[model samples]
Target: MEPLNNDMSSIPDRDALPYRDCVGIAVFNRDGNVFIGRRKGSDDPERSADFDAPWQMPQGGIDKGEDPLRAALRELYEETNITAVSLLAEAPEWIYYDLPEDMLGKALKGKYRGQRQRWFAFAFTGDDSEIDVEAPGGGKFHAEFEAWRWERLSRTPGLIVPFKREAYEKVVEAFIDIPQRFTHV
Candidate 1:
């Protein structure tokens, strides 16, 4: 991983870089609210522990030959213990977001300039008790979120880090038809 540099030597030209292939999961509850987590880790550019807007939905890199839907479900399960979900919708197009210059090659292990993500919206079918941010404690990933909540989709962009705001905004618009797809139970 490229270390976060104070020097500008490592920064790559924006248009000359590639975007990482990733998937973003937007898990919606029965009430039509979307799930977001308070990111953990200070000094982390993506999470920006010091920033007031530190919340984001579950997302992760798509492994080689993996199906996007499966990857979305896998990321959702790994980050939050909620597997009972019914696919609601998928974005009509992929969304891209660029990393701030400081994170151009430093974040995502310096692999890509930013993320080109496929977003999915799913309706939660399990009871709230089934969701757990903390699970398999001794595993590779402990907990990416310190807390979690379901919020109105319209407010998602405001809760996300500035760099990811455009992606979140697109996600919200892409899935704006969600509420009608799932009736509150």
Candidate 2:
């Protein structure tokens, strides 16, 4: 993975840029493990690679006027192909993260400085057979992940890109009790 570009001098106006509206989903299975996927490397050669910490929970942009929860469910199904789930919890407030300085103008199509995400946690009630990361949502949505797996929720922060790690940490804190809640169910 490429090192996080720390030079902020080049992107002096980044703070003025708007954050992309988005939703993030954390789907936990019967075992209390959370679902994560290995993000496919960017097709753009100029973008930094994510090989170092490529795993992340399913997330995506929220269309204008879309309800956050609805967007969360849509993104989850679109990215993971698992629709059998029950709402577990929602973060009390939106979590925000900034793109690294180097990514300010290069990521998110150069329109946003970062993402402001509303996160939802759901209990996965379906069998693992329902997962089809290779062609999620029956291929209606573009594939963002190359592979997928179940992982401990506590380990997610360490598995995501550095720029998004803090947001993941807040997510873990918000839903930390989720696993135990489903452990005996």
Candidate 3:
């Protein structure tokens, strides 16, 4: 398998984009609010991470032979330091987004031109304190914001990449009622 770049340079390009498979997750809390993290200043270009990276959702790629649900749970732990050891993740459906015409990777320069992703929704059964942004492994966007909150289902606070907004809306719509909090994991 190829190494996952922090900037995703390994994926194919627009037009000729090769097949790149990945996954994303939208995690909701008991109040039906979504978890969105604000990134650090050093990591964002033009400091957009403060706005765009601000509390979107947790998502990552599926490893070879690894299931997407498992990948989602892994990403939850890796990125937000939120563990699913206590909560349950139901079977999630796959959703996808194609990179814009100008954004496809070089390898996929001529292909349908972008990434195909599967998205999932999980209600966090853990406490906010369970999330340790300082966790030891996994890639994290350096953009950081001291403020974090539970966003309502009907609300959208931005920070979500333009191309991914619709997917976030869809995932939140599907899994908003699972549970608010738990500690079994």
Best by lDDT: 2
Per-residue lDDT of candidate 3, residues 79-153 (tens digit) = 776774433354355566665544443223245454566766667777888766554133353323344567664
TM-score of 3: 0.65
lDDT (C-alpha, whole model) for all candidates: 0.85, 0.88, 0.57
For TM-score, the strongest prediction is: 2
True lDDT of residue 93, candidate 2: 95
Q: Between the candidate structures 2 and 3, which one is better when assessed by TM-score?
A: 2
lDDT of 2 by residue, 44-73 (tens): 322246447878899999999999999998
Per-residue lDDT for 95 in model 1? 97
**Better-scoring candidate (TM-score), 1 or 2:** 2
State residue 172's C-alpha deviation in candidate 1, in Å: 0.9
Candidate numbers sorted by TM-score from highest down: 2, 1, 3
Weakest lDDT window of 10 consecutive positions for candidate 2: 42-51
* Candidate 1, 65-182: lDDT as tens digits: 9999999988888888778999988999999998887777788888788999999999899998877786612344568887899998889999998888898999989999896665
Q: Which 10-residue span in candidate 1 carries the lowest summed lDDT?
A: 133-142
Mark the regions of model 1 whose C-alpha exceeds 4 Å error after superposition.
1-8, 136-140, 180-185
Residue 83, model 1, lDDT: 85
